[model samples]
Target chain A: MLLSVEDFGIEFHDHDSPERVVEGVSFTLDKGEILGIVGESGSGKSMTALAIAGLLPRKKLKKEGRILFEGEDVLTMERHKLRGLQGDEICMIFQEPMTALNPTMKIGLQVEEALRIHHTEMNDAQRKERAIKWLKNVELDDPERVYESYPHQLSGGMRQRVMIAAAMVGNPQLLIADEATTALDVTVQAQIIKLLQKINKESQVAILFISHDLSLIRQISHNVLVMQNGHLVEKGAVDDIFEHPQQEYTRKLISAIPRVEL
Target chain B: MKKWLKKHKNFNFIAGAIITGVLLLTVLIGIFATPYDTTQMNVADKFAKPSFAHWMGCDNYGRDILSRVMEGMGNTFLIAVLTVLIGTVFGVIIGALCGYFGGLLDDILMRINDVLFSFPSILLALVIISLLGTGRLNVTLALGIAFIPSFARIVRSEVKKQCSLDYVKSAALMGAGHMRIIFVHILPNIMPVLLSSVMIGFNNAVLAEAGLSYLGIGVQPPAASLGRMLSEAQSFLFTAPWYAIFPGLVIVLTVLGFALLAEGTTEEE
Candidate 1:
């Protein structure tokens, strides 16, 4: 197993009360498999993704159980060790393409930043070459032009592609895409999903895809995990979850996917 | 630049730059040469009018008014620069730390900042100056300390705004250290906001230095300051009006220059 959570839980401390967000949730992801986590806004899907990457806010936060990445306990890992693990071993892309890259920095530098941080042994010229190669890998037309461009100079789809290239450049073992394509239009969203699948196939990198759109989840993910009100309601192959959802919450989620009959 | 000037009133930009520029040039030029000795007291020329020899006339002490004003401009400009430097460097670091990593440090530092913020900056500056004793250097340090909380507060809020943005978060996930994230990743994103804040800080610094000097505890004996000249000119208001007018005009122009420059930048945004 590449990643595993053994009865993990998260609670946020309010002034008078401690609210449980994820309760005894446990799952495992194998290398090179695309796992889908489908849930509504407050279903704890995104929180799980954050916890896996150790990105959750520490203030007013409490955690229990174990989040093991490759047999090491992530919750108790040394900060420097955790730092080394992230961006190199595991990477996460966020929702808003418009704001994911720094507006002031050129896209090329932003991508090279990842390489510069992790691959300190690699000199400037090699880092630049690697960044452009990944930019091209994302199939952006004229990667050379896109490399020098600022985040605002590109469209939403192009920016998303750039962000993906930045994330993928380090050759991370796993990619946690947290609502990554949610902000794009439907057509662009489809394109992004296809691109992600292509990247997954070409690179064989494990992916933890989090989103509310069941159809999009079905398109790219091999396995599906349905969450409801901080609980894992169902887990199975993507086809099984969609064609025959066992739990009431899972069925409702499946039924909610907008479709038009001829 | 032409398009921008046409789009906005831009009167403040032009007026502020010219006034500040002239004062700056005068002070800079004074480093090389001044018409007369600022400290030389000639009893015979005490009541001299604005002549070719002394363009701004002579003070009661017979010191050349033009020379004194030039040196005073230098003092005012130095204090302004020093105050801003102290405020921004320390303030930005403290604010970035507080905002990016909130918890005990945030509570402790921000509480201290809030206490400082509660007082009027001038009053706080006076209190600091009194504690540290008087002089141009002390006044600059005092005003710099007084300005710290506001700079910290502005940076704190702006840093908080960018803290949650994905670029910052992704940078963190990419194993970028806290210092790297704060200065490199987040700082540039908030540049426009910080720039406006620094400009406003400059205006306040210039005004505070002049005001403190006017109160008589600033830029002590022999060393001239615009405010010190104004204080001296108080007695010779009618007798040698130019003595008071020249320094007073410089102070007003410096203050207005900074204020308008700050206003213009924010307006552009």
Candidate 2:
């Protein structure tokens, strides 16, 4: 297994109450596989992803369980080692591309920053050239123009593409995209999904795609994990689960997707 | 220029630029040239009226008031600049640490800041100066300490707001360290707000320095300071009213210039 999350749980502590947000979640992902996690708004899917990245709020939350990436326990890993893993071994792309990018920075510099931090062997000129190449790989029409422009200067779809380029510049083994396309319109969403599919095929990088949209998940995910209110309600091959959902919650969630008949 | 001003609605910008420019220019001019030797005393020509030779007349020590006022502007400007610089460097580091690593560290730092904040800034400066003893450098140190709480408070709140933004979280996830996230990602975003507040801090520091000097604990004797001139002229307020009036006017101009400049920058933002 490339990544194995065993008995993963998360609890948020409040002054009056301690809420268990993610409970006993277990799953495994292999190299070059796409694992889609689908759930509603408060279903703890995002928390699970954040936990994998060690991005949860430190003071307010407690995480339990082991996340072994390449047989190394992520939770117990040294911070310096974990930092090395982040953006290099297991990168992530966030939702809301409009805000995910630093508005004051040029897109090229933002992408170059990722390379500059992780790839110490690459000089400034090499980092800039590689960042531009990544931008082109994401299918940006004028990579140079997009590279020179600020985040606010580009459209939402274009900015998201720049974000993807930044995340992928390091060419990590796994990419955790947390609702990465949810904020876009249907057409742009389809384009980004297709782009992700292309990147996965070409690079053979594993992806853990999280979203609330069932159809979108079905379009790209080979294996699907269904979550409901902090628990993994169902998990299976996408075809098997979509064609015949074993759990009532899974069936209800699949049925909730609006379908059009010819 | 009038048309450009009207187009941009930059009345405050123009006014601020002009007043601050003229005042700073006076300081620069004072460095090389004054109406007469600032410290030279001529008891024969003491209390001379505001004439062409000695523009603002002579002081009690027969020193040219205009020359002394110009020299005092230099001292006042130095104190304000140093105070703001010292306060900002320490303030930004403390605020960033408190805001970024919010928990026990934040609680402790903020409480200390609160204790400092509770006192009137001038009183705090007076206390500090008393302990450090009086001089230009001591006054700068005192005012700088007094200015820290306000700068820290402003920077802390600004950093807090910036930290909650997605860009900061994204940077962290991208393996940027805490220092990198704070300095590279958060600082630039909060700089405009921080800078405007620093300008306001500059205004307050100038006033506080004057207050300390007027209390006879800042910029000791023979070193011309606007506040000291005002204090000396108190006894001759009626006879040598020009002595008090000129320095008082310069102080007002300096404070107003900084206040308006701050307002102008905020509006531009």
Candidate 1 ranges beyond 4 A from true positions: B1-9
- TM-scores for candidates 1 onward, in order: 0.96, 0.97
Q: Please, what is the whole-model Cα lDDT of each candidate in the order they appear?
A: 0.90, 0.90
> Candidate 2 residues B34-117, lDDT tens each?
988988999987888898888898899999999999999999899999999999999999998999888899999999999999
Span of ten consecutive residues with least summed lDDT in model 1 chain B: B260-269
User: What is candidate 2's lDDT per residue for A162-232, written digit by digit as tens?
Assistant: 88899999998899999999899989999999999999999999999999999999999999999999999
| TM-score of chain B as predicted in candidate 2 | 0.97
- Which candidate's lDDT is highest? 2
> What TM-score does model 2 score on chain A?
0.98
Could you give the C-alpha RMSD of every candidate to the true structure, in order shown? 1.9, 1.5
* Candidate 1 RMSD to the real structure: 1.9
Model number 2 iRMSD: 0.9
Per-residue lDDT of candidate 1, residues B1-269 (tens digit): 78866887788888888888988899999978899988999999996999999998999989998998898888888888899999998899999999999888999999999999999988999998889999877898899999899989889989999987889998999999999999998998878888888887887887788788889877998898888788888988988889888888777778888888878777777
